[model samples]
Target: MKLENMVRKVYPNLMPYVCQLADLPIEEMKQALGKEQVYKLSFNENPLGPSPKAVKAMQEALLQLNLYPSSTGDALLARIGDKEGVEAKNVILSNGADEMIILVAQTFLEPEDEVIIPEVSFVQYLASTHMMGAKPVFSPMKEDLGVDLDAIIERITPATKTVFLCNPNNPTGTVIPADELRAFLKRVPENVLVVIDEAYHEYADDPEYLSSVEFVKTYKNVFVIRTFSKIYSLAAARIGYGIGQEELIEAIHHVRPPFNVNSIAQAGALASLDDEQHVSESRRINQFGRKLLAELFDELGMKYLKSATNFVCVDTGRDSGYMFDQLAKHGVIVRNLAGYGMTTSLRVSIGQPEEMQAFAAAMREILEKEEK
Candidate 1:
């Protein structure tokens, strides 16, 4: 007679996503720590905030709130096509990159299929695979914490349906180089799909880092997913899209939800794409912040990874869970990477100049006290 019991029987062993342990809301953190303000450097959000152009567009679009959004997101599609030089038919917009990941799993995965992902990569890859009752094959990362193309290729088998590659991978911001990817893609089985998740593409400045958008034109099995949430500062808007060959895109759209991208999100995303000035400014700020954080970490005698995205992974040489609490008390909130199997490191998002300074001060105070 219990609904919970019945639901559990029907959907047994559903693996829930383990999201990054983000900071509490600023006001909430202030209350908890008895601080005036708390510097939040947890989720890799843009420190500059959303684009002014996108904000204005969303404001104006509110007048038409009563109407439903364009289910297919044609305007946003055209903008993406123009920017990426792909046709509208090749793009499938979603609520965010999150939906894109789920859509791919739903559209392609069979109960007996397998999805190959980096061992410590995005949690959604495993969660989505489990959601579809597919097997998740985790390929271990390389020494530098980048995707091990060789290991992933070795894991491919007859049951491998898709491979999820999070370029400028979350938690650890390392990227797969263009040459390495080209070689790996060549070796991948033709039947298996390769998904390139570029949620933080705009922040990637490495000369060797390549966008997988071009691969879509050459490979039928290649799908490139992008989100406006990062550098565009449209995280709350939840607008993202997947780009692939026309046939693949058409198939995914068949499984997509109606009006998945709401009106405000579509309007904001479209405006964000056109605001190149804002993009440049965001990149500038991110680059500056990244450099500043790296320098600070070096000065603190901490080990950290060189990041391609708008966040730095720092090793605090102490229990990261304890470190995180101490940081909170010092009015700084950063992501504890223990969930990512990293107990001594924290993933800190690149914040504004003042926020970074505050983080540096707090980190110094805690670490120095620990040393004493």
Candidate 2:
């Protein structure tokens, strides 16, 4: 008997998420490039690093490694509730935003259900829906690469169980305007769940950008997901949470694993909330780096999205795979969008001034060589 036959039917058809340059080991890449320093802008990691308070808290938490974390994450949950202005009962903690997406699927999706997903949004939304053997209805993004609310609305049917929205969406970094989002939410059927992933919420400074957390307070179907991984620089820690109606949160708890979040991560995330200065500084620097990259792209005559997040997606006018390889050889790593079907675009994370300068120099060198 083939052991593979025993696996779930959906497992064989599902495509694994391709992480591009993020899959390459940084140390190995540095060694291969023969450089002591390599600028990694593939993953949208905080250039400032984790907050000092969070680091100190995690260090102190290390003393209790022998014990398990609070299964309920009571203290951390309370802190999150205070931060988000929601009751503790309305929040659900997960290992990461990815896991939160999975939990939502597990709790709500059935084999016959359909999940509406943006064609170019986060891969986890599609992955999670497939994991539950649910059909995913791909909604095409607008010409500007922004989520098309009306398109999603038009696609909804009786079988539609959930709609995934990524504000300041990954790769594209474009946000759903406040008024449009409000109208869309009102138009969506209350029976269908709407999952809004706001992993880059803290980075968005546009006045028109509205957080979906407020919607959660009034709409029973609205669920807002957030993470410490982005702004808090706790990507390795894998701390994320979801906010929704109390009943919806309770439903998710049924599928949540015991002690899912580790003590160190909880401590780091909890302390990170109090470090307002670090958050402010990170935001300021991100704005500066984003502007720098946008200016560089403009000078290069490249078409790029106007980003409200910590990354920019730019068309390279050449194969993204070639651009990725050339940049990697120059000790600079960026995300190639070939896997996402954007053959000529690359998503580059905003890094520190010196790191961005290195990337700028590498781009000039590569383009000059190509011209020659």
Candidate 3:
């Protein structure tokens, strides 16, 4: 038998989308850039090390590698319940929040089903929908980069299976304030799911920010996703969770693989939750870093979006592909935006003092060279 003939052929003509979906991102380009020790600000990864306590816990957990982790992940579930003020029955953990997003698509979407998303928010929402052969409907942001709630409300139809609300939205960093969120949710079709992704929530200190954890109990259609990656500095661990009603949680769990989360990740996440001091300091440093970047961008005469998340999107008024390459020459690596349909912008993640200083120095060099 010809091996090519034996291949599963679901996507012979449509395979490019799946291939490009896993294509190398800007952060991944660092390895091939020929830099021995480049500064990485492309991915909004916490530059700070893991909490001392979490590090210690992971070290101790290494010895227990012979045993399988708690299939229920009770300790991690209990900790999340205590913090979010919900019982363990209402929560489910995954390999990462991305996993939950995928499962949500699998649980609700049929081919050609409509999924509503903010035009400029997380791209994964679109990717997940398309993976299931569904359609994406978008409500583009206004000039300030904030979600236009009225625009979103206008698009809801009986075909809409879910609407992803990435408050403190990715790439742009704008948030949906409490009053606006309340109004939008009230009008959404009851049959559709609302995925409120708060991956960067711990970094969001705005008192007016209403995390969806509170809405889960009230709305049967609401699914709230949280990640250990941002504030907890657990990106490498790949553990995230969702909160919703009992039936929804059970439905998603059916599609999840047994032991989808590995042992070490569960241990580190459990420890990281209790590291209040680390979270506090990370927030403080992130605020300071935000201020520093704003001032630098102003001095350079470039326009930039104000952020509620850990990264800021800046408009360089030049092709971002050019800016990305020039900065790479000087050992500074920030995210290129051509993939986001922003050819004139780049995103910089908040970094520690020295990292920020180095990035600023490299940026100043690039702009000065351009002026000549």
Best by lDDT: 2
TM-score of each: 0.96, 0.97, 0.93
lDDT of 1: 0.89
What are the RMSD figures for all models against the true structure? Answer: 1.7, 1.3, 2.8
> What does candidate 1's lDDT look like per residue over 3-54, in tens digits?
6766633166575544332545667767777879778888788989998999
TM-score (C-alpha) between model 2 and the true structure = 0.97
TM-score sort, best first:
2, 1, 3
Candidate ranking (lDDT, best to worst): 2, 1, 3
Off by over 4 Å in 1: 2-5, 8-12, 15-23, 32-34
Off by over 4 Å in 3: 1-31
Worst 10-residue lDDT window, candidate 2: 16-25
At residue 262, candidate 2 shows an lDDT of: 95
Per-residue alpha-carbon lDDT of candidate 2 for residues 95-119, written as tens digits (9 for 90 to 100): 9899999999999999999999999
Once fitted onto the true fold, the runs of candidate 2 whose alpha carbons sit more than 4 angstroms away are 15-20, 32-34
